[model samples]
Target chain A: MKREDLQLLQKREWCKGCGICVAFCPTKVLIIDTDDKVTIANEDACIKCRQCEQRCPDYAIFLEEASDV
Target chain B: MRSSQLVEKYFRTKNLPHIWCPGCSLGIATRSLVVAIDELGLDKNKTVIVSGIGCSSRAVGYLDFNTIHTTHGRALAFATGVKLANPELHVIVISGDGDASAIGGNHLIHAARRNIDLTLLIFNNNIYGMTGGQFSPTTPHAALGTTAPFGVVEQPFDLVKLAEGAGATYVARGTAFHVNPLVKYYKNAIEHKGFSMVETICICPTYYGRQNKSGTAVQMMHWLKDSFVLNTAYDKMPEEKRQGKHVYGEFVKKDLPEYVEEYVGIIERLKGEEDA
Candidate 1:
């Protein structure tokens, strides 16, 4: 399976509008939205680093391998 | 010769095409460590590598040494046990900032405090690179991360000083751009008698570089070259000019009884008591 098949999503309500994910992302995949929520702006660029998943204080983000779905 | 060449020599086939990103520094750090081991002429059978969860932890799987890819942030603790059980074995711990400092902070301190005969190489990329770009404990204040949208508000930890304060006999810091020095530091740490640590400030091109707009791997290398000052190089510069940049090379080295040696002493004393 292609590695990019992994998917990352943010729970907008749980997001504190913190841009920690944006700053830590090596691929610039996530971006801060107008509503102060984090969104996947460049999903294709993600290397599934999972830095955001572990560092998020609110646990607002989740990652799932595409094969699992 | 480039250290990466040595890594290719012993790399496992099953794990071909490592999981790290193209410009990720973990691979470079891993290569440097492996090459250092080979250069030191260390017996693979006598060497044991332990690692905690993270992108850097995957090094255990790629190497041919006795390896344990343990749970997140517990590599040092396991390495401590391994060394105490078999003092003849050379133990090495490969970890990332989140795995080494954040979750494994306590183990790190105690291992250094006890002066275990183990080498710890921390891949400090500032941000957590594996779980998406998130602010790690090492992330600088006002830095952007997944959790810190505006900026990281918390102060980052100085891993080298922490290890020194925790009683490590040797400590140093290097970046991927300085591969030769990094390999040298790793070799020194491995040869040291007591707990030795090298904090490698690597680049998380996929996470950290992208967020910081550091361009690409080449750009990150340029930044690293510009940010770090070798001790010898720094000594030539004005003190004021050294501010805010990492001082590379050996920071601390001293003689101290390693944990296994002290433990062996205890065992001997107990035997004497039993005889009495």
Candidate 2:
């Protein structure tokens, strides 16, 4: 993903590629991109379980309200 | 509340990226703590967080509160002093397994015995991650560690049992994988009037996982999920089914007179007598 697309997701810089969020995502909605950081490969596949939000060590990825857009 | 919101509210944003290794459970465990504090609507000014040296102790630096990073294994001792000196402050001691049970073991039992109004949260990763993987007191029997290259022969200390035996008013156990219940345990522990200890079983992915072949951080979390059952459900399981499995829940909760209250009463009584 390019810099601007990456900036759209909140706290994306904090992700350390621990893989906890990507590994635990039930829908396989996330993937570690070539940059070794998490990028949403399939946003539509996200179930919004928030398990990733709960277990992320870096607080890097979380669900933002659609209204914030 | 949103994790981002909790981060903005409770953490020192300047230290946004923590020093902890990637995939460490300390972040998850630490998140539960802030969540508990937020859920309770505790006054940030009145809450004091004290910690001893370890990965868990590093949390104090990132949190936005009155925090103390004390000497090794002296977290509870320092917390006791904080509670006694202020009496109005809500003192919370954050310690690792080695910091709490190994080095500061004496202080732990004594604080529990005194029944002080301090909350001790033990982030038990089973091994000493900060020192490059030495065997800690909570390392499970036969677990691999640098010191126990041949495997640990001695039985590990059950922190819940130790706290309960030492007369703590509240004692509970939770794991990082079980974040929701862990937050509840933390909340209840803080609200308890007397000394309370909540042990959160965390993961040391770099050291413990690699040494024990426990797989990646995600796999270790799954291990926690599969190995530990809730206390209520654990009791109903058959003996064969319970083997190798640990239980997590509030093992003990009872009312007890707090140490500060008793000490204050003594001072008040003596002052009244002198006036007469």
Q: Given candidate 1, what's the lDDT at residue B164?
A: 94
Query: What DockQ does each prediction reach against the true complex?
Result: 0.02, 0.45
Error of 1 at B152 (Å): 0.4
Locate the minimum summed-lDDT window of 10 residues in model 2 chain B.
B1-10
Off by over 4 Å in 1: A1-69, B1-5, B272-276
Measured with C-alpha atoms, the lDDT of residue B24 in candidate 2 is 95
Cα lDDT tens digits, model 1, B94-148, are: 9999999999999999999998899999999998888999999999899899888
Worst 10 residues of 1 chain B by lDDT: B1-10
- Structural similarity to truth (TM-score) of each candidate: 0.76, 0.94
**Deviation from native of the Cα of residue B79 in model 2, angstroms:** 0.8
Per-model C-alpha lDDT, please? 0.81, 0.91
Judge candidate 2 against the unseen true structure and give its global Cα lDDT, from 0 to 1.
Answer: 0.91
**Model 1 residue B20 lDDT?**
70
Candidate 1 docking: what grade?
Answer: incorrect
